[model samples]
Target: MGHVTFFGVVTFVFRHSAGCTGNAISSPHRCILVPSFEIKGKNSMPKMYRTKLAAMVKNFPRYASANQPPNGEIRSYIESAGHTCELRDAGEFQSPADVVNLVSEHPKFEAALAIHLFKAGRLLMDIEIPFGVIFGGTDINEDVKVEQKRVVMEQVLLKARFAVAFTDKLKEEAELFLVSQSSKIYVQPQGIQTDVTEKFCWTEFLRSSGVRTEHVDELRVFLLVCGLRRVKDPLYLVEVFSKWHCENLLNVLVIIGPKIDPVLTAEVETVVKRTAGVFLAQERCQQELHAAMKRCFAVVNSSVSEGMSAAILEAMDLGVPVLARNIPGNAAVVQHEVTGLLYSSPQEFVRQSQRLLSDHELRERVVRNGKLYVEEHHGVKQERETYQRLVDTLH
Candidate 1:
């Protein structure tokens, strides 16, 4: 209800046009627009909940943003507010048998919060503790399609002390897969923080990314950030992007992120070697990545599905306009023309990318709006406080 300026106007027009309700947005710096449900007591100060927690994360050495989730943030929020937290990496939601065997020997904690439903939640089904579950990108979108996983996920939900969703759209998509647990599902958008490295070397980055030194400033770099995985559909736009680069040598497309999947990584490497003007950049630290993003013309998201993209949010925070594949999760963050451009097809993606290159007014508007959206809705303080409040349910 504040800042009724151009940002508000842009948000209002889009929400109405898309028939979005008051509660339809999210912030990863996602801008989910949902308020945190606090746990204030009557009269006296509210009691703080403090205890050790076994927070589960996608702990893969080749993963870029595994720690970029509610579990990672909540660990600090809980500890800083007077509690201890331990992170357990159960990468890829494989079998929970290994984790279950380990927790059986560890010291007990007060409560727990896990990122993926089946991975962490199911891991603790027999651990005997109150816990909350945060949905992941593939959890609600792809994995739940199978009947067995769907049933187990539902069971996880039925037993969880609480569940967190990055956006309302994800919550709805979840409802279609299982019986509605609207009462316990919290639409708390993930919070993102960006920090760039000091004196980052663009030339070094280019060299590492397989770009020629002579063509540093001559090329317009459009970065695609994603961990190499099947669900991410890293190759969805590669063929088209390669074609675009062939037509215009100045148009460079770089895929930068961790090699999450060995098979997918080999496939991507082969394509990049054979492709024109498309390179695979080395994975940089979070700070370096942010710095590289600043130099790029724009950021891109070609994920088949996303709960919310920390990369896109980081790009917007760094004043880089995003060109995202049009999917429900991406759409929740990007308001098409208002915040960023969305493309349903690779052809549309090229068209939008060109607009960002040639249409100054359009690009400027989106960049400004994207930054405003991130600031207004997503903040470290906001997410921390919200998680603290949600975790209080275990008390």
Candidate 2:
């Protein structure tokens, strides 16, 4: 066994007779770590039979990072159960047969998990492996609305050993489309860990991201964290945010996430170039991003849909106020005026954001309640236990 550290992250590597066993620790960047374990049986030291676990994650640079929460958290929980998991990029394969062919070359896997129902799950349908699908934000909120995507997702759900939804609202929405497998759908909110490092420097982040130094002293930052994609609607508030910025010159909306969609990324770049008080910061490690969120007046979410946002939960855990779009996925967690503020349109967002920034009492009340909500509902221990039980069913 040996270890390697990269990008300030440490990973353990262990060699096995069959090959190396590992799982990625998401964050600044992916760091694969292999755990040491021994398979057990009754009397004698039984021949070790490692429980091969395969995970297919969303194909995006951010998803590949150690700070993304979902994949890394799941991998950690699976490993804690004494299983060996290898996470692969689902986008690398062409079809279900391709996935099967790749897995066939490895040790017979006991179970497999795919990140998104409509994306990765559909590709794993015909694979000769017992697998489960986890509904991403788009799977329930966007993909299910498209007839073709919905049909394929329902088929995948039917073939799936089980399906996981991050929230009960999401489970209910999915059931409306996949009624037959409603019994197998489980609700497990994404576990969150806000581990912000003290090394984070807000001034340096602003300087590197092209934020104007002249306005730094009076800047009131609202961090909008989302990958640049159509579904995420990263630029939904760009025009209005810029207009408001011109009016006050105090508020700035800093968008941060990976470039998942090139066309959208280009559009965002164009908008940021012209829009005053609106900046696009490169994606930071989870800890650094959360630390930045803490520095901001509030965290914003402008997604068209969500499957329980780990970002929102992380902001709440960090005691940062949340301002999210009024979608079911966001609503399920943000109880308007309670845990966080929810808005339906750009104008509503502006109005609510102003209130959050001006009303000290409102901000304090909501931030306090949001932290409590996460502690009471999204406890990491509870999420770990629930996933462990789900993995047990695979046996």
Q: Rate the local accuracy (lDDT) of all candidates.
A: 0.66, 0.67
- Which lDDT tens digits does candidate 1 get at residues 1-395? 00000000000000011222233222000111110110001111133333345555553221254223633345556544444454545542245554344333323344556666765556656545566777875778877988898888898899887788888988998888877898899887778778888979998898888898587887799988777777678788888988998889889888887776788899999999998888999887777888999999988888887888888888888999999988888899999999999999999999999998899999999999999999987887778877767655654
Segments in model 2 whose C-alpha atoms lie over 4 Å from true places? 1-50, 59-69, 214-217
Local lDDT at 87 for model 2? 59
Question: How many residue pairs in model 1 have overlapping backbones?
Answer: 7
How many clashes (backbone N, Cα, C below 3 Å) per candidate?
Answer: 7, 6
Error of 2 at 102 (Å): 1.1
For candidate 1, the lDDT comes to 0.66
- Model 1 C-alpha RMSD vs. true structure (Å) is 11.8
Question: What TM-score should be assigned to candidate 1?
Answer: 0.84
Clashing pairs in 1: 25-32, 26-30, 26-31, 26-32, 27-30, 27-31, 27-32
Q: Say which candidate scores most in lDDT.
A: 2
